[model samples]
Target: MEKVLSKKRLQIPQVVAALKHRNFRLFWGGQCISLIGTWMQNVAQSWLVLELTRSAFWLGVVSTFQFLPMTLFSLYAGTLIDRFPKKKMLIFTQAGLMTLAFILAVDTWMHTVKLWHVLILAVLLGVMNTFDMPARQAFMIELVGEADLMNAIVLNSSIFNAARVVGPSVSGLVIAKLGIALCFLINAVSFLPVITGIWLIRLPKPVQPASRRCQEGIWQGIKAGLDFVRKTPGIFVPLALLAVINVFAFNFNVLVPLYAKNVFHAGAKTYGFLMGANGFGAIIGSVILAIRSAHGPKMRSLFIAAAGVSIFELLLVPAKSYTLAYLLLGITGLWVITFTTNCNSLLQVQSPPNMRGRVMSIYTLVFGGLVPLGSFLSGSMAHAWGAPAALGLGALISLAFTVALVIWRPSLLKQEISFKWQD
Candidate 1:
């Protein structure tokens, strides 16, 4: 009995294995708290935009303003991330984000919140995020090294989805009782734990300064990153697929709110619950990946997940009831995290350590930078037809793209990834 118990205790699940690293544990805990507030703000912001404008086009415009900086400057931001210490840069970005949240909260509280105020603040928030996203992605490797890199990435996604599960649901209740201002205020305060966690992290060794070649010039660095992606088939293929999927299939921010109002004839609480349902599915998906972290990322799984997202999204077209929509969105959420998490791991594992930041910047660029265009497309489509039609069209486009990729490169499904780059 004693021997059996000892053996069982030694078998820690792969899902939580990344937390064994002290720095990663701190970072994970902090993010878990912070992301919930972020989601609350996200839910409130979308609903707030609708309350102010009641136009899907205007909602897209606000989203466009928020992500425009990333579209324009993410490549340049990547160079900066490569040239600096990620932790310090992250601290600065977090503080900037916190300040913006506070400003928005104050404006909303004072009833001086105009659409323009939200737009301008969103632009500032985008500026902060262009730097923060890639830095954060690149920093994961440093926290746990290559041995636990996949575990760390999946763990990060798990917490993010977990927050998605908690944040919007709670935000619905908060928004119903308090107001949208409180959500922003809570988000502003939530930054403290993450900032403190990053500050407390002690890397095993000092990170090296950027190579002279990397510091040559911002334009040159951007060119190099792009050139590298163009040449690497493994990295390039996933990115291309992600770009298509991101532009069409991932406009839930714009569509979900509209669905709640225009389709379901429901209000804020229903919208929050819908968003929460999607997050719940995402949490389940992340848990599945966490359990299978030992397998790392696979090309076949990536394609399948991409296809799954489109298929599930397409099913939403026939959903007439809130329960059916919620169920479909949950399933869609599952496929989304699986596809994105695999793409992220594939990019990081494939790139040389020196180029990881730039590679991830490209990832951030497509994943987020393109949100403006996607949001605009979805919003315009929703305005012209309806939320369901817009969503159905995007899903159709995404499914077509996935099919085209497989036809174009039948070999991609069988390609085995090599983790040859030294950490």
Candidate 2:
């Protein structure tokens, strides 16, 4: 028994081996602090929008304004990341986001914040995110190297989920006591640590372009990335499924708040608790993936996780009791981490180093870009039919996708296709 216990203890470090690297440790530590504040703002913003507009339709509108830029310019942003120094680009984006948060804080403090002010700020942040998401996602492998990419990605999810748990819980207290403006102010200040960490870190020399052909121009770069995804089944299939899921299943930002306010007749505290519950489940899922990094190809894991998410979401629609609702949300969170983390890590592994930025940009475009549409649908559905129905609609769409994938899984998994492209 003592030997078995010792063996278990020995395995713990292997699970977090990515943290042994200096650059990644620094980056992860900074992001852990930053993401907590980001989640806080997410909750506070949703509540604030509800407070300001008193309409779920406007909630969707706000979300659409925030994410619209990703749909418009993420491909160009991806090309920019591929050309520029990623860390520096991240600094600029983070700074821009910080400035927006501060503007929100001041506007709220002065009691001058209106629906237009909020929408404009959301649009600005969305613009920053178009550049930020792809750069950050692609930067992770560079920090820890490809050998530990799975562990690093899992750890990253764990931190984000940990923040998800902590942030809303804290925001609930802050909103209840200090008021909502403080949440935005706190989030703005939180960017400092990450900015400082990025500035201090040293990266290895970048690989020179092996062929001038790939670097011909911005349009060529965009076309190259698109063509790669178009032809690569391993990458394209998962992305297609992810995009479908994004459009219907991943409208939590809209659904959760509506359910708290309209369905449950709860306050900000209850909403925060619900979001925290989801985060708690997500952390559990991330831990499982961290421990077993070699869980086979990502597509298989993604499909399984998607099914779990859909089932839990459907269960959530009928959950009348607060406890039962929390339980269902938590279960959905667990599968959310598993599905997204697998999709991200798998896509990273499948792409060449040169194309990683563009591929992830496409990913950001599909995922972030579609949220506006989903949010609009979710908000509109909630306004018309109530929150439960909106939630059910998303759950049903997710389940339909899962059913379709299961039907096609055998042939999809067996087919071996080359990614080579000829123009």
Candidate 3:
């Protein structure tokens, strides 16, 4: 752990001071608050579904509902992002999420929450994210210019992982005491930081329009993004690995409580502790990346990390003790995020900016689109082969992906990432 912290060799921008941008600082602070709330809602919402029905199938169904909007709206949303001001679009998203959080809180507090409400809110949130994810991603470069691209990416991961740490543990306490509604309320409060940040940002004037190209139509843009991916097997190859991990290891968000109840015979607090451990590891990984992420000579360490995740995923499956499970889950979070954040940085550096919006939309597509499938498969797999076996298979697939990527993009291993400033 200490060595990982010290191994800072990746070429960060000389302008390590991008965080000094008043607007970027505001954005970062607000996003950190808001993302923590998002994680809280995720944990609370899943637990609420299980509480209402105690059925994993219902759990899978609700998860599916949440992600359906992303599948339906993502491509068009990316096109809209290209055409509009991302700052204004994100303000809308943040405000809308706050509204959804308030409704969820009220429903839970009143004890009137039902499975349908969960599904409704989940889908609505997904719809909001369809626009939100793309806009926010494109917005990152604008925040600090291309000079701070790596910093912004690492910092983004930091905000998310930080919230992951605080949100779940706190939500556990909130859910156990005031009920899940409190978790929702806390999440609503979380959005305030981001809203304030957005209000504070002084964006550069919008770029002059490129006359709409032949690919300006929404479906046409979608096709273009797809074509780009098909031709650049390099991008898709690494991307597919992340997608599989999300379905199997990343989707573990929906499975922790199941693990708590069935495997460890623990309650909400215990489950919260498990989540916090994972978050802790995730934060550490993000910080390490932020500090010394490689500019070139892509590390062979990613392959090793992929293999470690499989082992950790397997270790958590049948563990009888919470202590043992926490250790495994922490390791699981660390390696998986390390692998993912590194891949995103590499892909971002390698991709052309003209097509960045579309390339990123494809990133969102696989990232979110695969979840519903994973949620269903994981739930069903847990139902049949047992939780441990299902997760083990996922780990195995991840290992296979790592091996294939190394073989296919051996040049990826030789190329060093370099940062260039944009006017």
Best of the candidates, TM-score: 1
TM-score of 2: 0.95
Name the lDDT value of residue 224 in candidate 3.
77
Q: In candidate 1, which residue pairs get closer than 3 Å at backbone N, Cα or C atoms, i.e. clash?
A: none
TM-score of each candidate structure, all chains considered together: 0.97, 0.95, 0.91
lDDT tens digits by residue: candidate 3, 238-307: 6777776777767676677778777777777777878888888888877676666434214454556776
C-alpha RMSD values across all candidates: 1.9, 2.9, 3.7
lDDT of 1 at 131: 95
Instruction: For candidate 1, write residues 1-423 as lDDT tens digits.
Output: 999988656545666889989999889889989999899999999988998998999999999999999999999999888888899999999999999999989999999999999999999999999999999999998999888899999999988998888999999889999999999999999999999999999986455655654557888888999999999989999999999999999999999998889889998899999999889999999989988888889999999999999999999987889999999999999999999999999999998877888999999999999999999999999999999899999999999999998998899999998786795
lDDT of 2: 0.87
Candidate 2, 83-170: lDDT as tens digits:
8788899999999988999999899988989999999999999999999999999998889886777788899899999999999999
Q: lDDT per prediction? A: 0.92, 0.87, 0.75
Flag regions of model 1 displaced more than 4 Å: 1-11, 205-207, 210-215
- Which residues of candidate 2, in runs, are more than 4 Å off? 1-10, 209-214, 413-423
lDDT of 1: 0.92
Highest lDDT against the true fold, candidate: 1
